[model samples]
Target chain A: MPVVELEGVTKAYDGGVVGLQRASVSIGRGEFVFLVGPTGCGKSTCIRLLLKELEPSEGEVRIAGKPLSKIPRKRVPMLRRNVGTVFQDYKLLPNRTVYDNVAYSLEVIGEGRDQIRRKVPDILRLVGLSTKLHAYPDQLSGGEQQRVSIARAFVNHPPLLLADEPTGNLDPETSIGIMQLIYRINRTGTTVVVATHDKEMVDKMRRRVVELREGRIVRDQESGLYRPDESTTEFAIRLRGELGIGAEGHPN
Target chain B: MFFFKEALRGLRRSTAPALAAMLTVLITALVLGVFIPIVQATMGAASDVRDRVVVDIYVAEGASPAERESAQRAIERTANVRSVEFISKDEALARAREKNPRAFREGSELLGSNPLPASFRIVPDDPTKVGQVVDRLAPKGPEGAREPQLTAIDEVRYREEDTQQILSVTGLVTVVTGGLALLLVVASVALIANTIRLSIFARRREVEVMRLVGATNWFIRWPFMIEGVIVGFTGVALAVVLLTAAKESVLEPLSDRWAFLAAPDTIAYPLLVGLLVLAGVAVSAAGSGLTLRRFLKV
Candidate 1:
């Protein structure tokens, strides 16, 4: 079974506004997937649904083949132990050091001090932030902060990592560097789902891309590039590739 | 434990507020510790003076010893008198000599006779009943002599000066110290509550992150609550120190200044500490709980 599966999912917010409309997708373990859509196309909402921050108004969501509702409330934290989320805004707590921010996930799960001291350094090293462990979030550059956020997400060694526009605020070089770190982490058997409008980054990575338009899945394919329907789509198609058209009837 | 470290780090960020809170708790506990015992001691001395009051009932002239004994029995049987001791005319003069040696030595030369009257000293159980017993002893009939034959009681005297001083000081100190303690309590509550609130506000993002991480309401709330308790306990410790200092320097001297005021005894020390700590923890918990209600709920 897929690591994350959403079937006939619909989300209608308060005041009768619909966030998503009957969306369906299955993300397998160890797969790197890109969720591409225009702004307000329910990308963040979809991420929130997977994070169990919000329950869908209709249909069911299953994580690792267990329905989200079937998991008891007491076990929700444990369920989150298997999934890590990163925000484009780099939700690093401003009051905490980089090491503290990374160690927070483990601390929430009641890991001992020795375990945190041992594991936080390893995770920070993994994210190329070993030297910046003592730095506060405000002191770091945007890319460094994003790296800290990534470190916090991956510290628990969760099998699934959700990135919601992970590079939304970085320069191209820094964004690429972050993408490389994410790719490296993904290679270590963590299922990575990145939500972004960065067509160039998505195409350069060349992962399975799921394209959404107006809250519905427009396309899902492996090694796929961004489509040209929504914002920056034309740029995505140009940055990546397109479906080859044959000149002859049978073979090109 | 990490949360506590986080809390301590947060507290270190602003030393002044922490100190201000600690000082508030200290001053409050000191005032409480001192004010309570003073009021209690004052009340104790007042009641003691009131209980020691006795009414002296003089016997009629030429009354037989047996009649005087019966009169003493009657005085004892009265509802207000706790006990009655009869003093013969000679005995009265002798007691007077003991009280005033010069009065005994020159009494015959000045008066030309032994004119002192025999009296029954009446000790009333209730201090308030002394006046009633004196009134009852006065002559009831217009035709009768001003002094009755079997008078219920006579002159009523009490240690009024000492009791009055005790009562007045107790009342004044009670008002002043009660007001001060109330003010300090309010200040402590506000200081502790604001400190915890600021800490929670600083960590609001982390709290939200924990919520997103699927931490239960209790798990998210526990750390802040624990941090509040730590703050309260620390404040209480500082308060106990201040109270100890006040007990030695202020309360002891005050007790000496008024010997009737009981010493700051060691027995009340544990009770003072217990009350201060309990109040600190209760206030901290209540304050943190009220402030975190909004954040803890899903």
Candidate 2:
């Protein structure tokens, strides 16, 4: 069974901005799914929906076969316990050491110290950040910080992992390294969904790619590259001609 | 134990704000500690004064010796009267000399001519009874006795000004101390709420991450709420220490030197300590709960 299911999900922000438009997608356990889209095409929103960060206005989102809405408020933490989240910004608490950052997810779920003690070191080593355990977030490089963020996300060994532009701030080499790390985590039966726009990296990987255009899914294919059907000049022509009557700098 | 260690790290991370909050609470508690015991002692001493004041009534001229005895018996029987003593003219002079040796010289021009009155000194076990005794014992004389007095008593003497002044001062101390304590309590609540609010703000991103992971509302809120309580507890402990030191080193010494005000250490110390600690825990818990409610929704 799929670990996450989204059916015709739509999200509209206040003041009439649409974040997602009737989007539907499914991701199975151990599957590595890449979301590729232009800026503001709901790629991040899609990941957020799967993570239950935002509720869809028009459709249902289900995690592990249970409707997100049907999950009781008190059980939200339990639901999170089985899922791991990473962000491009590397949201490690500044005051905490790298070890504490990875251990925090366990602490937040009230996992006993013994479990945290046994699990955190191993997870840090898996992320290749064990040597930096005592280092604070500010002391680490951008790559190291992102690694810490990844380690924190994977520390609890959640069955599902959502990374929102996890490599957005890293160099291309570092980006590939992080993607490889994501692939390793996926091999462990954790479904991985990454939202990014790195064309070269996405093309070389040749994984399942779901591309978004203007808040809608334009293409979804297995072992796909980044926007294989849409040419850049065609988009430029559309930007200048078919969408010419709209405001300048607006893309369709 | 681990949370405590974490809390210590958190405090070290944000030392400036934590120290400021701690000092604010400490000063508030110190003022409370100093005033609470002093107020108690003042109140106690006032009541003691009310009970101990004695009223003396002098006998009329030429009242036979038997009438003096009757006056003494009458005063002793009065409501709230603890005891009554008769003082002869010679004894009155003797008491006067004892009170002030200079007033009664060794060799006066006339030695036996100290024409002081024979007075009945009356003391009531309860201060409230002084007025009652005065009221019940009126003039018991012939038909033509003077309007205000005097077959049995010629004059009455009581330290009305001194008693009134002491009670007024004690009442004022109680009102000021109580009012200030109430003010500090309100301020402590405000400060604690503000501290928790800032602490919540710092952890806002962590809360967002937890929500993303599908953490239950309780799971996300428990740690921050606990942090608020910890801040409150630490602030109170600091304040208590400051208070104890101030009372021992300053307020106690001042009270001891001032005869009118009993020393606070012996009298008000326990009550002060109890009130400060209680205020600390109550304000901290309430403040934490109130502030954390806003963040729990995330």
Candidate 3:
């Protein structure tokens, strides 16, 4: 069964603003998918939908083959525990050490002391932060802090992982490291979905890319380019370049 | 158990707003501690004053027993009369002697016959209604010729001016003091609640992230609520300590000067303390729950 599926889902907000318009996509287990678009193109909306943080206006959202509409509000937390998530801000408790930050996820789910002790250390080591266990969030670099966030997200070995602009605040080199860490996690049989603006990384990875434009899915391609087949505006620009038209001023 | 440990850990790593919430609760509890006694004393004093709004109707000393009996009945029939007691001339003399034995000792012995007039003491059910009893029983005919109207009665007096003055003054005192006390109590309690809200608001981002990581609402709520309870308890404890230290040094000396403060109806200090503790714990728990709800909407 597909691990994530959206069948004709729509999400609309107040003032007639539609966040996602009849967008449908499905992801099989262990698939790595990137949602790429410009700002306000509904990338975050898609991520929020999968997390059940939003209610689709028009259709069905199925996670792990169970319809989201059927899940009671009381059961949402359990659903979240099984879906690890990362964000751009590296939402770590400011006062907690890196080790405790990762351990918290386990503790939240009522993991036993032995299990928490075993898993926190193992995950911190996996994220290459075992040496920085005692370091507070403020004491770490942005890259290291994002690593701690990722470690916290992945400690439970959740079946599905979602990252929204995971490297939006990081330098290009650090962004690559974060993406690599995410790629490695996907390899462990966890279905991964990323909503991002890093066009260069998306093009370099050549993964399945689902591109959004004004709340609608404009393209869904396997091994897709970030700027898939020239859009009308891009096509116009290319034609202009070839014809030796004015580049800086409109040809009158 | 795990949540409690988490709560303690949070308190140890306390922020400025958390400390502020604690201070607000302490100040609120302190206000209540001192104000509760004053309120109790004022209410007691007001009631004590109200009980004195009695009207006395005096009958002529030369009147026959039948005339005095009819005079007593007229006082009883007056409007707003709760009860009327007849005071025979001899009994009136005896009460006067009892009240001031030294002053009456020689005076009463010298009088051949009891010079005191028989009287009817009137008590109204409502103190403010004392004027109604006075107006109905007092002689009301043309000034000099008023006696034919209430022939057996010589005078009907309620200290009407004094009764009216007491009613208005006490009413004003209660309305003003009660209104001020009410305002202070609401402001103080709301301050405590808002301080708790601000403390939770300071950690809203932390709450947001926890929700992102799939923490249940209860999981997010439990630690903060526990933290609030601790803050509230400590704040109330400090206030109680301050109040206790001042109870004898402050309240006792003041009560000696203010008779109403030592009245039997005053609220027991221990009971007031218990109520303060309960208020602190209750306000803290409720404030935390209500404020955290806004953040838990996601």
Candidate 4:
């Protein structure tokens, strides 16, 4: 079964604004997928829907083969426990140390002290931050902070990992390190979905890419580059426009 | 254990607002402590004065024995009349001389007579109903019947103004203290709520992070609630200490100086302490809980 599936999902905000209209996608287990789109193109909306943060206006969202609409409000946390999430800004608790930051996820779910002690250090070592366990977020570099966030997300070994521009704020070199860490995490049989506008990284990775334009999927292909194919379709024209190429599908 | 630690940490981080909340609770509790006893004491003094109020019926000096007997019988038959004691002319003279010997001597020498009328002191069953008993015994008639007749009674006298003053003072004391207590309570709650709101606002980002990390609403709320309870208990403890000190150093000395104005002893010290602590906890906990509802929408 697909680990993540959105069948005809639609999201409309107030005042008749379309966030995502009839958007659909699916991801098999252990697959690495990149969700590339411009701002307001429903990338964050899609991630939010998967996390059950926002309800889809008109469709089914099934994570791990269980429909989200069927999950009670009290069970959202349970769903979240099984899904790891990372953000570009590194949403680490400023008051906590790196070790505590990773351990917090387990503590919230009432994991035993022995399990937390075993897992937090192991995950931190995986993210290459085992030596910086006592450092606070403010004490770390941007790359180090993002690593803490990654460690926190992956501490539980969730089946699905979602990273929303995990390296958006980093330098190119640091971004590469962060991407490598995520790639390694995805290799451990965990389905990874990254939503980003990182063109260089998308072109370099050549993984499965799902492109969105104005709340609709414009392209879905394995080994896709950052830019669209050499076609004159309407979606290709809009994609070219978004990529800042000329109207005739050629670089300026 | 985690909640407790988090709550203590929260309290430590927001020391300024927590201290302000504690002070508000202290001031509120102090006002209640002082006024509650004062109001009780005032009422007690008023009732004491009321119990001592009696009506005095002065008879003419030349009244016969039969007339005195009739007057006594009339007083006994009056509703709410508890008891009646008759003082003869000689007994009245002797009592007057004992009370003010100089005035008695001067008056007897100047007038060459006892110059005192026999009287009956009538006590009522209920001190509050002295007016009714007095009215029953001394009935008013039309103006045509106002002439001085050959009746045994010369005049009727009681402390009308004193009783009225006590009643009015106690009534005013009750109303003013009750209002002030209510106002203080409301002010305390508002102050506490505002303080909690500021603290929560400062940590709104932290709350968002917790929500994103799948922390339940109760998990996010327990820390604030515990912080509020801590603030409340601390405030009550401080207020109780101040009240105890004030009672020992100020109230005891004042009560000693003014022997007639009794101190409040109806409520025991332990019970008062327990009540103050309970009120402090309740107000602070309720204030935090109520204010937190707005921020827990996540």
Best by lDDT: 3
* Residue A170 lDDT (model 1): 87
Model 2, A1-252: lDDT tens per residue? 788888898999789989889888888878888899989999888876765557788899998888897876566667777878888898778888999887878887778989999999998888788788999999999888988888888888899898889889988657767877787899988998888997766766779999898788888899887777658875565445423332221110
A12-39: candidate 4 lDDT, tens digit per residue: 9888888898988999999999999898
* lDDT per residue as tens, model 3, B124-161: 98998776566666645666333324788888776768
- Which portions of model 2 show Cα errors greater than 4 Å? A107-118, A230-252, B38-180, B210-238, B256-260, B263-267
- Residue-wise lDDT of candidate 1 within A67-134, one digit each (tens)? 88777656777777678888888887766789888777887788888999999999888777888888
TM-score list, all predictions: 0.69, 0.70, 0.83, 0.76
Worst 10 residues of 1 chain A by lDDT: A243-252
Residue clash pairs of candidate 2: A76-B214, A76-B215, A76-B216, A77-B215, A77-B216, A80-B213, A80-B214
State the fnat of candidate 2 relative to the true structure. 0.56
Ranked by DockQ, the better of candidates 1 and 3 is 3
Winner by DockQ = 3
The pairs that clash in candidate 1 are: none
Worst 10 residues of 2 chain A by lDDT: A243-252
Sorted into a CAPRI-style docking class, model 3 comes out as medium
Cα displacement (angstroms), candidate 2, residue A185, comes to 1.9
Q: What is the C-alpha lDDT of each candidate?
A: 0.74, 0.73, 0.85, 0.82
lDDT of 2 by residue, B1-298 (tens): 5555665666678777666656656666666565556556666665665555778788887788887777677667777778888888889988888887876775333575776788888887766456556656653247734222346778777676775675567557657766875786677668666765675576677666656655566554555545555665676677777766765787568766786545433354566567677776666556656665666663
DockQ of 2: 0.35
TM-score of 3: 0.83
Which of the two candidates, 1 or 4, achieves a greater TM-score against the reference? 4
Best by TM-score: 3
DockQ scores of the candidates: 0.28, 0.35, 0.49, 0.41
